[model samples]
Target: MDTATHFAMGFGLAGLAYLDPVVASTPALAGAVMIGTVIGSQAPDLDGLVRLRGTAAYVRNHRGVSHSVPALFLWTGAIFVLIQAIMPQAHWFHLLSWIFLAVCLHVFVDLFNSYGTKGLYPFRDKWVALNAIFIFDPFIFAAHLVGFLLWASGVDPGRSFLLIYIIIAGYYYWRVQVQKRMTELVRQRIGKTGTYTIIPTLSWTNWTFVAKTEHHWYVGELISGEVIILDTFTIKPENERIAAAKKSFKVQSFLAFTHHVHVETKERPFGYEVKWIDLRYRSRFQGKSHYMFVAVVYLDFDLTIRDSFVGWIHRGEDQLAKKLDSNRQLS
Candidate 1:
């Protein structure tokens, strides 16, 4: 989920806090909880600061460790302690409970999106992406906006937010059903799939799908009850050169962050270029050419990595050429 949605969710959680009699009765404690909720909601995303290091670092660690299980407890405790230190008059127990809920909510909702979290970190580093929701859902945002408007209009914030959450919960349940049906439809069409993923778009009926068989990757779109095959790629057997390229820092990090990856190796004039693409993000814009989130590694004839770029980049071939050319000029 986007930051705005997370912040709005925090705000709604604060409203739900009214259910607690202690929060309802104590004004100072209620104010502290509200403030804590808002901060806790976005604290997990503080890892966005990793972008300063580079796209590789950002991709590798953005939701990798910061959104993990241990991080969840750490963030909750840290936020509670910080808030408690500042507002000593506020009841400690209520404040801690609200802040902890806010932080947990932030991590929990992220699991539903296409770009998921490694929330189970120490236990398993595997990324858990439900692919049931878009990173930014307009409907979720609108609900929060409406709730804010109602609160601003002098409506009881707690009750209004509670009602909004009930509706949102129903919406999530419906989305899950829709996603299940979409997957079923796709599986029926593409029999004997090894890995199948249906990523939700902004529209309820429209979805993007990626399925892997033993031989090929099936990438397509399900729009208006139709499965439109966008493009397909043949799965290549891994070789020593490709294996060597995989050991590169960029490729290793990219692998850690994504699944259903399709690797393509091409021989160039100077070296070999290995492209690692995440099929889950495959898309075609305005009926133009298809694109997928990709990383590229340029290797010498001996299979030593020359240069690389990772993360959600476009035009893998063109970008690789430009990066190699730039490196050549610098050398």
Candidate 2:
């Protein structure tokens, strides 16, 4: 989920905390819990500061360690200690409880989205994306927004948020069913020769589908139960050129973070420009060009990496040339 949604969820949780008799009895303690909840909600994303070093560092570690199981306890304890240090008179039990819930909820809700967290880090160093929800879900955001408004208008926030959460839980359950149906449809249409990755989009009926067999790669869209093949490419995992290209640091870093990698090599005047794209994030530009999360590596005549960048880029020769030129100069 996005930052705004996480923050709103934290606030909603704080509203629901009012149902606790301990919190309702003390106004000062309730205020402390509210502040702690809001901060704990966004603290996990503090790893985003790694982008200051570079996008590659950010990509490799943003949610990698911070959203792990150990980090959940770490964030909760750290926030609890800080709040206690600032307000010694406040009730520690109520404040810490909400803070812990806020931090746990932040990591838990993130598991529902396509860009998921490495929540089981030390135990399992793998990205676990459910692909049931979009990164930015308007429905979830609006539901929380309405609850916040109602709380501000003198409505009993505890009951209102509790009811809202029940509905949100049902929404998630329905999305899971939709995702399962879509996956079954893709499996039936494509046969069982290859592995399929079905990623849900903003619309409930639309999905981005990718399949990789022993010899080919299939990229398409599933709309309203119909499978539409947008493009197909031959897979050559044993090719010398691709093998050499994967040795680049940029490709390795990208591979660490993404699941489905689509590599394309183009010969340029300087060298072979190898582009590694994460197929899970397919989006259109101007209703014509297709773009995905990409990382580009320029290898010289001897296959030495000359320059590289890891982030979004236009998927056109001219645009790529311009980006490469800019990257080279910056390097």
Candidate 3:
């Protein structure tokens, strides 16, 4: 989930704190629980501080260790101690309970989105992306907003959010069913032997998908139960130049972050340009296809790395090429 949504959920959990008799009776303890919940909700994302280092470092470690099993308990304990220090009169166990719930919910929700977390780290080093929910679902956010509004307007927050959560639970079930149907459509219409990755978009009825067969890559969208293939690329065999490009640290980090990757190599006037596209993300504009997430590496005639760029592409392909050209010249 995005930062805003996480913060909103923190408030929702604080509203839920109204259910506790101790918190409901004491204003100071209630304030302490609110602070504890908000901080606990964002504790795992402290890894965002890694952005100060560089994009490569951020991508490699963003959700890797920070959202792990041990981190959850560690964050809860640290947040509880901090909040308790500020408000000694607050009940220890009640503040700790709300903080722990906030931390656990933060990690649990991240697993449902496309950019999943390493929740099972150390025990199993793999990203657990259900791909059933978008990173920022408007419906989920609206529910939290409405619940908060009602709480602000003097509605009993405990009763209001309780009903909201039940509806949200049903919404999650429906989404899981929709995800299953999308997977079935791909298997029936495309090939069952291949691997299919379903990526949810912000729109409810639309989805993006990347299917890998034995010899080709299929990139498409699912709209209104229809599988609309936007583009296709062949899975070419790698050569020596291509092999050398993957040795760079930037390319290695990209490979570690994603699984559905496509690599292309082209000869340039100065050197060779090796492009890696994460097929899970594709953009279309004005009847053309654009790969949004990519890493471009420029190698000399001898395949020595000269320059590289590994990040998301906001501008069109032409601008991306110009940017790569600029980077190569500076190098």
Model number with the top TM-score: 3
Per-residue lDDT over 271-300 for candidate 2, one digit per residue giving the tens place of the 0 to 100 score: 677887777666666666565578888777
Would you list the C-alpha lDDT of every candidate in the order shown? 0.83, 0.83, 0.87
At residue 23, give the lDDT of candidate 2: 87
Instruction: At residue 265, give the lDDT of candidate 1.
Output: 87
- TM-score per candidate: 0.94, 0.93, 0.95
Worst 10 residues of 1 by lDDT: 322-331
**In what order do the candidates fall by lDDT, top score first?**
3, 1, 2
Poorest 10 consecutive residues of model 2 by lDDT? 322-331
Better of 1 and 2 by lDDT: 1
Local accuracy of candidate 1 as per-residue lDDT tens digits, 1-331 = 9988998898888888988989989888888888889999999999999899988888888887888888877888888878768876447778888888898888888999888998888898688988888989999999999988998898888898889989998988998888889888888888875888899988878999988888989998999778877778898889987898888887887888887888888887777878888887764455546355777787888888887777654553455456557346323
What is the per-residue lDDT of model 3 for residues 111-150, given as tens digits with 9 covering 90 to 100?
9888888999989898888899999999999999999899
**Which scores greater on TM-score, model 1 or model 3?**
3
What TM-score would you give candidate 2 relative to the actual structure? 0.93
